[model samples]
Target: MKQPKGVFVTGIGTEVGKTVTAALLVRTLKADYWKPVQSGDLNHTDTMKVRKWAGEAAGTFHPERYRLNLPMSPHASAADDGVTIQLQDFELPDTRNFLIVEGAGGLHVPLNDQDCIIDLIQRLGLPVVLVSRHYLGSINHTLLSVEALRHRGISIAGLIFNGDPHPSTESIIEKMTGLQPLFQLGEMQALNDECFERQVQRVGQACKTLLDGL
Candidate 1:
């Protein structure tokens, strides 16, 4: 069978709008969404959010390999739940449709003593679509993330700025990283079909080349 086309979605740090970015990618690509490891908020998992926001365009919602109840780092949560997350535990879901894999926290987020989210991304062999939200120290964080991925020789599909754009900050990041924004998503007043669909209409075309290359 042909492997599905996909990209891994990661952020500079936690709560940096990775979920929102992933949802946008899902809607744009009309892909399947999967979070291999969820470290809490089982009541409102990222999978649920993406499924709701991505609307009918989203394909299957793949089950997480590990669901830890505490809303902490995956390693700690897995330990609390008496689970040991291994690299081998993650296998891409069977889907002919494109797959959008969302990561927990940042690249350095630990899944076990030896492996991290970046390791999992490397293992999966998918290019990354990094989500970066502007903040005081975001430049440092975003650069470090790009550096790490480059060090690993991982392909970065492109960058996505999740909220309002900061021109100076964005310019510097682009100059330094040499990565232009695949698209920028403005702040939304609410999360609804209208918001998602509008975003899809605005930025969906920017992703076409990435999808085509995949």
Candidate 2:
């Protein structure tokens, strides 16, 4: 299989497991990881989490461009920090290795007054690997996410279903989007090297397919 290219990792909404999915991709593809704008949790940011869980298979763990103190939306958090996030403030880390960029929240998440996460994804020019988890409104959220990305003419690497499987929910998403189902990951009770390795084995092939297609 060809080396999978880098991808932007986004989700249906916040707390939908974008970091975990990004770590999984990092382990599966042996790729570098980046979270450009970390709203909060400076001590243990998403970059650190991916590094911890992804283990040695991961390449480089790039630092965040904007590290806000509050755990809120980028715009709100940046306001508290006395910083204004500009679209030009971000630049892709210089790397030859495959990169897994984990976005702060959903595609519509606002980074500043003029731009949102989707705008940043567009600026980065990487295909998205959308992370979706089964929940009450996930179907609507997932479909809307797909629609938004498609409308922007951004390429999507594939869809990743995280957390417990709801076959019926998963089916409709697939049926409606006709998106390539990369893999499904169960909730990780433990975040450790052992757990990451086991999950990597489960989705390794699909990760390769994602890379090859990209």
Residue-level lDDT tens digits of model 2 in 109-182 = 99989899999999988999899988899999999999999999999898989998889999989999998578
Candidate 1: which pairs clash? none
All models: lDDT?
0.92, 0.90
Model 1 per-residue lDDT at 48:
93
Report the poorest 10 consecutive residues by lDDT, candidate 1.
1-10
Clashing pairs in 2: 4-211
- TM-score for candidate 1: 0.98
Q: Which ten residues in a row have the lowest lDDT in candidate 2?
A: 1-10
Angstrom error of the Cα, residue 195, model 2: value is: 1.1
Summarize candidate 1's per-residue lDDT along 84-185 as a digit string, tens digits.
999998888889888999999999999999999999999998999999999999999999999999999999998988788799999999999999899988
TM-score of each: 0.98, 0.96
Give residue 68's error in model 1 in angstroms: 0.7
**Model 2 C-alpha lDDT versus the unseen true structure:** 0.90
